[model samples]
Target: MLVAAGVVIAALTGSAGCYTDPGYKGRPSDAWIAQLAAPGLDGRLDAAAALGEVLRLQPNAPKVVTALVAALADTSDPVRVAAASAIRHAGRGGGRVREQLQRDAVPAVAALLADSAHPVVRTQAVAVLRDFGPDAAPTSAPALAGALSDPDPFVRRPAAEALGALGEAAQLVAASLARAATRDGDFRVRRAAAHALALVGGPPGTVGPALVGALRDTVELVREAAAEGMGQRGADGLSEWTVPAAAGAGDPMAMLRATATADPNPRVRIAAVTALGLVGDRASRPALRQALADRDATVRREAEHALSALHRRGGQDPGMEEPSRADLCRSNPGGPGC
Candidate 1:
């Protein structure tokens, strides 16, 4: 084994020479690559971690990406976990590296998502897929959707969460998420499903009704996620409460107000305040003002920020318009209003 390591190191530094990034002070010796395939678990695990650092130092190198791709199938659980982590580092660059991940590394990681015996591997695999962005469709969407059915919450949570990252491609699985949001046994899975639904977006009629139903989930966290999804309906003019009208006064604006003002969980109140700002609902001002005194400092701060955003928008209204730098600076990232 020692002689084999020496031979491998020699090759890395030979005519074909090792690849090195600006931060990489030395060539990535083949010994590290060999360790990746070594019989000892620690050697393989350490190799995966070392490769992660190499990728960080010299990102977008296809050679390392190929090596890490092979590591994804390592029988040792730790090595697979480490390899998944390293894949993220290798695939960080948007162009070539992302393309490499899409072609080489990503498929291997996607395969791991179905490994029901190891939930951590699935979670790490989801992390890698999250970077695929919208282009992840035609493949990752279905794979991620399938993960939502995994028995382990650790696996199901990320699968449900990754679907939202697909953007419009999420439409492929939006109905599935709607079902998961309402019926998943675990509160975390349901909460994640509800939150993901907001990002995937759909006709307010279909998506909105599903999310509203979640708002009344016995679990307060699920309700918080449902409240958040309504605010994120973007600029669409759809009513957020039509589906739940029969259930009672399901006006989302009203629900946001109620949750912001009365939920026992301070964290949920904090999310409610942030959502009010995103929804641009000026009518929520009174409840938000009351939230200004919330026991949780985070809730108080979110309330204040929401009020400021509302105030800025109000200044933009026709008759109430002002030339104050506040709203103007909002259009631009930094200025006097900032």
Candidate 2:
């Protein structure tokens, strides 16, 4: 049997031991490129592994990148998987090399999301898209958005996560993500979607309600992610939350406060307390103060930070100097205080 399986495993996962073809030792990049087109699965797998090694040493090698991009479409699944893995490795760092891959390889890898028959290949394809982050957003977002509805949760979770990695560029698909967050059968997918909704900056009118609904998920991690997303959206985002009356009466801050005080999970409580600091006004101080007495030390610590933020927003910092009379007079003129 070809060592192609080992190469695929090691390339997909970093834990496997290294595998090298002794015959190709000391071969030049051109030699590996040629071998990629050679007959049989063994030769192609070896070439894919060698090119990945070259990429690790010289990430900017144009010939190696070109060869790998071509290999992504190879008829053999192993070769394609290995090729995607190699491209993923080259994209681990940000610079000219990764930028080149973004322009060259993203579309090809994205095609695999829709065309590949194997779920593993599709999963690896999503991983490559994610490794490119925001740079891959323009080409990869639509494909990734479609992958959210895939039957496999393995693919769905990563697709949601990849969209999250796209950041604000993914706003166009915010509604799709909101649906996944609220209705996905898998909690892992739901958690990833919740986190993505926070980063993707969809219409807060849509995203805010989805996240609030997620707070009631049966899974604690999903609830925790929703609370964290609330904090990430901050005050401006929170202002647009238009949930129905049955769902906290459209008041996200109140919902966060209730979660901080009542959630069974300490991590969820911590996230809720932290969110209050980011979105809450001076009125949130009472809830934060109450959180300071919680059993979990982290929740109490986050509560302290939230209280500090509230104090700073209200201009109550202990080190703040009182406004000067001249300064007040220049601004107020006809008013009692400036």
Candidate 3:
């Protein structure tokens, strides 16, 4: 009986040793927190990673939030990266916890955006700001705008996306976003900037010109994004673009009409057609009609939908003649309008 009891006791001890608690009940153990300050890199890395898991399980813990915020400024880039990423994960928690995490960690994470020595750290920092959503905007926008100039396209892309996530609160940086949309070296950065510009771009006047200009970008994606942004900007956004050719704003309507009817990529044409349908009036019928005959069936389908939308709005104008094909060609020489 004694031998049997010993075996049962040993089995219970072995199972207890093997049992891994999925997470902490409240604050993590002090030993785990101390590991974050351990002398060796591996020890600190492991601790930071473990804390991320802890955050996943106990996302509202103030102690874990404090430890991770401190880790954002750690001596090692990987540790800082892990901390920023962990904070971003934690920002996904329930309402009060997400708000608290953003309030506590935004400044620290925003500071990392300037860590030029480590682009990966900056990238992760923007991601945290991005995940925090609009709440992080007021404090983090300027830093994110600064990141648009980072030498890395990867960093710039997410920074633009983060600013976009901030929505209208990020209006102060509209000019910066405009510059990135029209002039950034990378197509991906340019695309992201254009998408963001549509959201936080303030008024049509501030962002319209840049988005219209982006329609001329060599990359089809950039042009498509520009077209979509114009559509999102609505009537006021397209007001400047739709003026008669003689108004001397360089005939933006003609350009948009040309894009709708003649852009080489069917996706771009579809986007342009959609934009014209949303904002276009009687003057845009010619381009929409031309799109109806596009080689791509999708463009034709979008054109059909656009025409229906136009009819629903009672968009026809008695005074404005549908520009003749010859006139369209004259306004945009060598385009589908021609």
Candidate 4:
């Protein structure tokens, strides 16, 4: 083994004379190639660094990608690190590298996602799946949804975030977020679900309820995300919120108004009001008018204007209008509004 290492090294450094030793798996030429490819040695930063350069120099090399994928199977930390970096590099460039990532065994990829002890490796694995995007189609969604239950947010957050990029995967993962928002123990997971919901933006049936529920979430960040997600779902369905007949008297707007008016976190309260506007109904007049009296001056002004628009349109309105920047800001402060 020592002699083999020496021969590989000698060929890499170009010290071997012109020779054909059949016994050497790696001839002098192979050594130079290996050196250029520069697979990292046992648990050393430099080896990982050199392997990174090799990936850059030969981005299209199938052997290098395969070798890196194989490295993940090793118990050696250094080799696994180098391998992870190499796969990440390949994944970023797409094309052949992306294909390779998709073909990699589930357990190998799952190991990288599940093992939180190595944040760098776990992040890389999630990133690879993210970059794979459409190419990852079928597998990406399932892998990410599964990761939502991971022991670590470092892994789970990225997985949730990655799902946002999967377009078609949105519907499938929406169920997971719906479930997670209600049951996940970590505040961060709930927050991640809200963020993922924003990325998977769609119609009212798909995003509205989840977002509305998020407004009432115990965590402030999740509430913020829910508000943002609603805005991203477009400004159509929520237009009637400013009218008297909108969403009916028992509409969820009442809940949003209560939160907007009195939530402990000023931001969450603001988000609640903005959500009400997005779901605009004439019946919201009393609530929005009540908001005008809010100590938060921003909420007061917006409430007055949203009421004005709803009253002007009456019942024949298109149920969709671009909310003025001033009005949106009043409800959400810095939030992304209609």
TM-score per candidate:
0.71, 0.78, 0.78, 0.63
Q: What would the per-residue lDDT of candidate 3 be over residues 78-192, giving only the tens digit for each residue?
A: 8888877877667656655555566668878888876777888888888888877776778889989999999999999999988987877898888899899999999999998
Cα lDDT listed for each candidate: 0.72, 0.76, 0.74, 0.57
Model 3 misplaced stretches (Cα beyond 4 Å): 1-29, 94-96, 232-247, 250-255, 278-283, 315-338
Per-residue C-alpha lDDT of model 4 across residues 206-296, encoded as one tens digit per residue: 4555655666788888887665554344345353222234434223345566666777776766665665565555555666666767888
> What local lDDT does model 3 show for residue 112?
83
Candidate 1 local lDDT, 203-296, one digit each (tens): 5566766776676688988988877765676435334333445555445556668789888988778778888877777777889878978889
- The 10 consecutive residues of candidate 2 with the worst lDDT sum are 1-10
Native-to-model Cα distance after best TM-score fit, residue 313 in candidate 1, in Å: 3.2
- Looking at model 2, how many pairs of residues clash? 0
Pick the winner on lDDT between candidates 3 and 4.
3
Which prediction has more favorable TM-score, 3 or 4? 3
Better of 2 and 3 by lDDT: 2
Name the best candidate (by TM-score).
2
- Regarding lDDT, does 2 or 4 come out ahead? 2
Question: For model 1, what is the C-alpha lDDT against the true structure?
Answer: 0.72
- Between prediction 1 and prediction 4, the one with superior lDDT is 1
> Which is the better candidate, 1 or 3, if ranked by TM-score?
3
Q: What's the candidate order when arranged by decreasing TM-score?
A: 2, 3, 1, 4
Better of 1 and 2 by lDDT: 2
After superposing candidate 4 on the true structure, give the runs of residues whose Cα lies further than 4 Å from its correct spot: 1-47, 56-58, 92-94, 105-111, 114-120, 165-168, 201-210, 235-262, 272-293, 300-338
Error of 1 at 317 (Å): 9.2
